[model samples]
Target: MEATPQAPSPLEETQRSGLALGLVVWVFSLLGVLGALYARWAWTPHSVTVEGASIQHLFDVILAIILVAFVLVHLLLGYFIVRYRARGSESALYFPHHTALEVTYTAVPAVVMVALSVAGILLWSRVHAAPPPDAFVVEVRGEQFGWSARYPGPDGKLGRVDNRIQRPFNVDPEDPAGRDDVTSPEIYLVVNRPNRILLRTRDVQHSFWVPAFRLKKDLLPGATTELVLTPTQRGEFDLACAELCGVGHYTMAGKVRVVTQQEFDRWLRQQGRR
Candidate 1:
């Protein structure tokens, strides 16, 4: 039997409502993108250090360029969709691929990648270069859920520490270095000085992250990892565990306090006397 055409009812109203809602969503999405671009461009720089300023400025430029390109691409795409929508009597045009257009697009991106890579490498080298002779050395140990730090005394030579022989709240009876090493829950450092952090994990992987300083390094079991950071600004920064540990992943939070050399010394002396 031939099918009969159905008359429109409340169901047709529902369809229209859905279409209107979809349009609203699309428009809001475009506005959301614009808002994000504005926020990124107008963000204030909080860290006054050179390294921090460089990172913020670099990201701002990169994000602005990306947002502009994104906006242009979408604008052209929307225009094409409306301009070339199917009509009752018209057929679609067919064209062969343009080699010139492909080459131009590929070359531009290649040139951009090369420039970005060079700049990244230079920044990395600046952060990871070997510390000077007077640089402060600190050893960091990661256990299941906490960080323990050890600072070499005034001698500047890190007394050796073997975790196997070391006990909680007490130094190992065997390792001689544990006698002079300063261990604490708080990882302290002297600002405006070259500081090297030696990282190690006892059980699983952990990451030493200080967002303010823009520094992060993984802490692995057995082997020791190291990263150099010189904090030129003095303030309190949040340190988070970058790697996913277990159910306690969300609770792994650490504090980073950047202070002057004099304050650091006072804190160190107080800890030593304890």
Candidate 2:
């Protein structure tokens, strides 16, 4: 004979009411969190570089993955809470393991992680790749309190400055090639032209950073580091040190001036053959 349906006890009805209320509150809370996150995303300062744009795209992909996981987990948690709520008539069901479910969860994450790593490696290689042969070269020196820039003289060659020759002015008086080098208080570049910067530090370690160009590199005392980029837009931007070198680290700053090719040539001439 089939079992007859029985009415729920008054206490059981109260428990169900409470469970429903809790579920509504929890779901609304998740929605509120989602809304807040969206608002934060809408209002944020951003970097303006071709590579930086690509990096942001990568960030979005990772964020999407995280969000999907978040929503799925929350839904499951809510489902379990409602489905197995305290009911006197029902008993628990136990299954040790589900092979397909386990395999799916493991395999999906492994695939996603591998894909992300591969994409990151490709982007890294592209950004760090060699600049073209016709690229113009510039030199930058990071010091305790400020930065010094050097442009190739009329010879279109940067005079070599040895790291061993440390002095008051941060330049070697002995190198003839470097004698013609012009040190500028700021970095000036022609828009849309490839500029490769040679980086060095005078006393300690420092990092050369320009946000708009999405370029940064460490300046070590005894070695030279290189960063290459081409400015697409004409604007003035701040160049900052990303490292904590010492007491005057906050003052270690510079500027990037992206101008027309003609203007850049004229400015170089104005600096003259130093």
Candidate 3:
């Protein structure tokens, strides 16, 4: 008769399980890192506004922190899983807790969060503080399935708009300031000049998003919102409605054209004639 076969030791089984789990964790973590890197390199849009650079910088800082923490935490977790696997007949160590470790973990995250909050607040203030005295102003109105832009004519003032009024562009027929208002299907901005965009909605909620400018503002029904940015480059960019309003949400799109001051003025004149 053949000699009786012996079963594998508990320690060997534990080692195999620990090694498998650790390998899985490490592999997934690596893949996640690679995917993030690829997306950042291939998908991030170019910054075309002064504020876009700052926004991108803040994003990079935040992403770096998150990726670092993610890698470190996973690395340590995998290491612990394999290093502390159960050994047969060995009692488990039960050193309840370490005060230093707990405090370090809590305090580090708290400090990091506070710092990030402060940075965000400062950036917000700068973005929405105030437009320059001579900043170019345009009004963007959102309706279901489309967007419209209104430029103040030579009057340099946007006429009063009332949602209650049933009229083209909702312009108050009584407000003389609106008479010269030129409405367009596209937005026109002057490169290298501060632009103040007034956002409004006709029926439901909508969001005005210009990816290249790194700005997104909501067009809330019955209310007005504002966004200010200075285009540093002159080019045509795509504008999108970043909200779901109705069945035709996907079709609500527009174009943003940044041109020289002279070109913008000439275009305004041409639009006013129409």
Number of clashing residue pairs in every model?
0, 2, 0
TM-score of 1: 0.79
Which residues of candidate 3, in runs, are more than 4 Å off?
1-10
lDDT of 3 by residue, 205-246 (tens): 999999989999999998889999999999998899999999
lDDT measured at residue 8 in model 3 versus the true structure, 0 to 100: 76
- lDDT score for candidate 1 against the true structure: 0.73
Check candidate 3 and list the clashing pairs.
none
Worst 10 residues of 1 by lDDT: 41-50
> Which model, 1 or 2, shows the larger lDDT?
2
* Candidate ordering by lDDT (highest first): 3, 2, 1
Task: Indicate the worst ten consecutive residues by lDDT in candidate 2.
Answer: 39-48
lDDT of each: 0.73, 0.78, 0.91
Each candidate: RMSD? 5.3, 6.3, 2.0
Deviation of model 2 at 256, angstroms: 2.1
Candidate 1 regions with alpha-carbon error over 4 angstroms: 1-29, 38-50, 168-178
**Per-residue lDDT of candidate 2, residues 99-183 (tens digit):** 9999999999999999999999998897788988878788888888898888877778776666566653356777676667788
Tens-place lDDT digits, model 1, residues 1-274: 9888987666566555555655555576599687886676465436534566667666766776677767677666555555554444567988889899999989987887787778778877886778778777788777768778888776666665455644652345565655667778887776888778889887799998876766679998767799777778787777788999877877778777777888988988998898
